[model samples]
Target: MAYQVLARKYRPQRFSDVAGQEHVTRTLLNALAQGRIAHGYIFSGHRGIGKTTIARILAMALNCRTAIGTEQRPTPEPCGVCESCTEIRAGNAVDVIEIDAATNRGIDEIRELRDAARYSPARDRYKIYILDEAHQITDAAFNALLKTLEEPPDHVIFMMATTQPEDFPQTIRSRCQHFSFHAVRFEEILTQLRTIAVEEDVIAEDAALALLAEAGDGSMRDALSIMDQAIASAPLDNGKARLDAEQIRELMGSVPNTVFERLMEAISENQSAPVIEEINRLINAGNSPSQLARQFVRYLRNALMARIAGENSELLQISPDERARAARSAMLFSEEDLTRFLQVMLRTFDELNYRQEQRFHLELGLLKLVHLQRLLPVEELLSQLPAPTAGKGSLGGGPLPGTLPRLQAAPAPARPAAPAQSPARPAAPARTEAPIAEPTRPAFSPFEADRDRKITSEATTPAAASAAPPAPQALTPIETAARAAETRATEATRTTETRATEKMQPAAVVGVAEPIAEGALALAAEADTAPEAAAGGSLDLDRIREAICAALEREGHNTATALLDAGDWKQSNGAIEVTLAIKKTMLALTMNAEADKICRNTLKQLGVGEKLVFLPGEASSAAAAARPRAAASGSVQAAAMENPLVRQAQELFRAEVRTVLDLRDRK
Candidate 1:
């Protein structure tokens, strides 16, 4: 008899025999017992995970005769002694027609199947069509079979299996019930391999069996195939099929724990020579490039895990000796160093699959890692450079808030191009005019020096009279610094605003540079609409009340209309108010000040102004005794202070307190 391949010989004959597919098997069995059988079905999974095998078993179940009587109906499991089961086992089941869709994927084949699907079963209870690799079928064939799949004969069932479900047409998929099988777990694969080894009477060590399991990569068919290879290669000195760890390791071409330890030691010392030697040894020992890459990635991963936990080696999947070696090696380097090595290994591993110069790529990766300690952390890198002297204002605050204290730029002599290296290897100091201190200055703002120069230059020279450094007599150093920063930020803001206005302004006005005529017309219209706009560059309060009234009235808001009509507005130093029937300070406080500004400006364009004075008609009983004005001002200040967006904008842009405008005023 011809030798049967392990894949076919160990093929799961029943649902119970199928490994690592309990959920799928149980669902199908229950469906069959409940008579909830669908006419068309699709089975999907990765290669060698039993997509075809499951489809075949499902076919056998559908056509099974010697049914086990249950409380409701017969279950999905078919009795092996039945004629239907015998025929299926022999691959000559009359009712269960198996088709290899890959080779026979034509419209003609599908048409013939479609024609045959209409007929009753030849002998069994159900006519089953099993198409393996159904995704390989041509588009024309799929289109031809779609109608039959959607509404097949009562006795005809289509079981289509494919490794690539995504490749199948959506229409065909929608017409069938779908089931996806996942890769078997490592434990499950190990259990199955052990059972097979025992059944084959091969004396295999647990470690040897585990090695075979790992080599299988979560596939039973793969596990069996690997086991067969091991069995064939096993020593038969005593006419016994016994396998030892040494034989398994030799056959697997796995680097021994000693070699791995040596490599680990080299990595920890940042020595490239020993690492290269190990790679060469592995290559000479017949380790495939892909396998070597996988091993390196695995080692890096295990090393990281071992480093983090600071415990025993049992947690890692690698051998106990390897884990111990990794733990020791992990102690030799920092997390950052290990991270760099992992990144290099990953890049090299990815390149191995595509690049012709595998050794060069791998060696280069190793060499780069050997020198990885030279690279500094991001913060260190930035702090090493002399920060630009008061660079343009950043949108968000520089770096993260509450980050590490800013490092003072070392005196040019001691500050080399590179940052302070690992303590063991201090960088050579640069030649400079000044002796470097041990970074004692607290948070040096590069802006401080520039601001000081600007101040001295302004105090002595007359060029900056218009720019106007505030009088030196009035301000302290810190206040002066704050003021300078604010002035610079404001000037930067004004420049950007000017550019934006230039872009948006009409060509004729743009040529005039300032657009004075348009500004005058806008100013006039604004003053007419919102009289308070004349006070500053923008609108004040009264116009906003009138605009709100108009808008609310247009929207059929009568209450708002009456309130606005009767409301009295008053204007003060920089604020305005409109009297309201009720006093809800909290509600009023919630109004966005920026949105109010936009509304006020918009109303000013319509020739409306004054200020929106909201007088509390029903004054609180404590108003006179407690000072309502002070309380109200405090509330508004508190509201602005609590606003995250406002606070962020104020701090980020260094906006100065110019004036606070109230939304109430009378014309």
Candidate 2:
């Protein structure tokens, strides 16, 4: 006779022999021992989790003649040597009948079962029904069995086993006692496999067994099945099964971490040929694209774990050799880079299913892995770079001054050492002409100087005024005394002219501009004629805007349009409502307050009592109103030059390129 497969030969025969399901087994054993069994029991869990086997053991326990004869149905453990136990193990038990619910899912079949269930057990203490894949039963059959399940005969017991418990009707499920099982753990599966291997006198390395255990993924049956195949594929001598890790890997077509290490080394070194050659070699060795993708993902995961855990890597469940290889691979790639590679491999796996040629996908994925240094996200790539040569200005100007580049524990780019001292900022632009000379004659009398000093001292402390001296000039005692009466006028004109020049001049010139350089010019332009206005009134919107534009141009136009077109003047209740449009709500509030203060201060100088209301609107509206008046022509008129609605949408969304979605969803 041919040898029995390991799945069947090593199947769990007793409750204790089952792995990862002690809770379900212990409860059933207690019920059987105490004679508190329910009419129906439902066992549910993932595949290969001992659901069917538990159902069989329950059936045998119910019909055990030895226990019944001894009236010691007292012990929950079924004596496997008993006639009922032996028959059930052989799959030909009479009273303990196992039905494949998947095959016998018809209404008529269930009706026949219901009719037969009405009779007493034939030559047994109880009649046990084991329904496998019970969820696959037809709706009609489920309805027919529902009534019987709720009120079955005292001797009849129903055990339904299904991977999907939710598929059954709630009524049917409520009538049954539910038992949930969990997938076997890797360590538990490995321990069990080791025991079986030793018992069978199989010679195998622990590493080889570990690989089998991981592939099992909490499935004892699957692990045993793979082990059996490995044994058969091994070189046999004197009827003894023997195998090594290499042979197991070869048979399973699993490329070890060494392959991953090589690929990573090639990637780090920027060599594509090795990875390409390896891909071809793997293809020749019969590895499919999907399988390769899975292997790549596994390697990537190991690499990431190694990178995070570093030397303290006791947390990982990998072999020592694999851990060492992982450590090496981790040194070559960042966790983020590995994560990106894993993500791409997953996508490659999906693409493989749709690709007419799978090799192409696998090769492409491998090539991507080899060239990962170039494919990493910009942030991640920057993290891998060395502290940016201190203002050598990275290939793309590193993070702005005083700001550190974000890092993520990735390998930084290899670069030369930077100076200990930080690089200096560029010098300001050169002065075009010689400095202007101060007047030799006094501009004020001694009394005027004293009054001016008194006024400055009254507004602020004497120390502050002394620290910031006014323009230099010689003065007579009498002229200085007279200057005291005109101190307010002189100071007011000085402040006004200083502001005008600062606003209208470039930043480079603002620092050195003299008080008298443009004071006369500014005063002429702003001379007030309205009797209600102050004699020195100089407040104007055009002058302020021009000043601001000049001050900002020296820095850059980056925010010129945004600042200018971000405000609008609206007529509201006989007052000018200055509505500022800004993308950021906080910025809008800030600009509105600043504009109100500036307008009020300037208006006070102009002798205006009206309060300025700084409101806020969409920035796009301001942009529309600010556009230059265009000559209406054939295409220009048709194009609707600077429409307020479209400009509003563009500014609000910050998207210059408009699409149909933008037009259709305007608020």
Candidate 3:
């Protein structure tokens, strides 16, 4: 006899020998045990997942001669030793007729089958008609057999095996007992392959068997056939076939997933040059662009599954090694990124089918992965906008983005160095002190009414301001007299308790920006003494803006309140104006009619000026070269463009206004 392939040699001879179709097998066994065999049966599933095999086994189980005289078989499984079972297993059973419906699927064939079903078994207990690929039968042929099939003779059994059960007429299917089978799982197929390898004396690596099983794609026969081909080509060592993963991959012309793993790593690291170089190398090495993209799509799918269900889960059909590699690749990206990569590669694979330049398209797809990694949403970029200070995102508060608070906790003045022994610290790390300490000061927001609540006592002390000036500090008599009169007037206005407190004020106060620079201290001293060079003029105007914001909050104008409160305040020409530090493009949103109304009511009540004024903050001004004149679009878009807050928002987020909806008519 010619050497048989693994699929034929290992073909299941009994229902009990079948794998991954327990539902159909168990049902058939029970029916045979109870002597309740049906006249007609339909077995349907994937092409190689035991549809025809189970049909043949069921025939043997029904006609096995072990229980020829008995009412029911003790074991529904075929007795392989019996003549009837042996003949059926050998495919030469006299009573069993196997027809390839694909070749003879006309009404004439159906009529002949109908005539044949009328006869009894020649020798076995029952005659069986097995039609393989039954779906190939025409609708007319199915109709011709429908009557006989609805009531087949008791001594005959009709078994039809098909991959596509839907193609059979509803009449034919309704009359038969339909058993839908499922594809064998990865583990089951792998287990079966391992058993075959051991029995065949093939020394195969587990990874090689895994590769065959994955290639099988849920079909056991497909896996076994691949294994048969692999064994023939596997190099012989000590008269035993030796198989490895790389050998199997070479045979299949599939790139190892590790190659894709490396590609993904380069992509995650934004190494576009390396990514393109790798693709070019793979193409130069005789890897087909289409095949490479196909494998990449599979690799990406596995990575996506590994991302969702973890690397060790049953959800991934890959072997343990590939699963691990896929998981490592998945870890480099977020779940969304993995999903996006999968979608991109899937489209790339699709494009490879008809495109003339497969190499260029595949490289473009891989490059897209690196490009997608750099994409930032407008909202995210806006969130990353700098706060008050450079490299710091906070305005004396933690609402903004930055790691200053966490960094300050480590390098703060209170945290001593590990090897230090002295209580007094050196100024070696002094530069680190100025930046980390200033912005996170919680009480120093320029927006709040009590921003001066933690004023430095030494910087504001009248007595300290009046201390004797050195000879280097030139001062005319008029300047000296003016300073004296200023100090005296401040003293006269203060109570006795206030005067004594100023005399003893501490150098630093808690919650103030710590480690104030010497230059700032001198500047504050000058402002306090001379009262001539204060950068922000007097505090009274600042007080006026705060009062108006507070009034708006009380009036339930929270939007206006937050807006006005986040800005700087200045009074000029007897008019109080608030400079809101909102986003430049979104400046339009802040200047809506509603804002205008709130501003008018609040500033009017404060008696600052007739018209409420809004000044763009420094960030808003810096975003655009100058405020753009509103274009002549429709009123809604024109208004959106004209509103200072909306324009400020556009600039802040660095987003373009794609479409504007008119909600005036909408509820």
lDDT of each: 0.61, 0.63, 0.67
The most accurate candidate by TM-score is 3
Q: For residues 71-180, what per-residue lDDT tens digits would candidate 3 score against the true structure?
A: 45457777777888889888999899999999999999889888987888889888899999999999899889888988878888889999899898888888889999
Show the lowest summed lDDT stretch of 10 residues, model 3.
Answer: 518-527
Q: Which is better, 1 or 3, measured by TM-score?
A: 3
Q: What lDDT does candidate 1 reach at residue 59?
A: 78
Q: Candidate 2, which ten residues in sequence have the lowest lDDT sum?
A: 518-527
TM-score of each: 0.56, 0.58, 0.59
Cα RMSD, model 1? 19.9
Clashes (N, CA, C under 3 Å) per candidate:
29, 20, 26
| Winner on TM-score (2 vs 3) | 3
Tens digit of per-residue lDDT, candidate 1, span 80-171: 66788878978998889999999899999999999998899888889999999899999999999988888888999999898889989999
Residue 167 error for model 1, in Å?
1.2
lDDT of 2 at 86: 90
Best by lDDT: 3
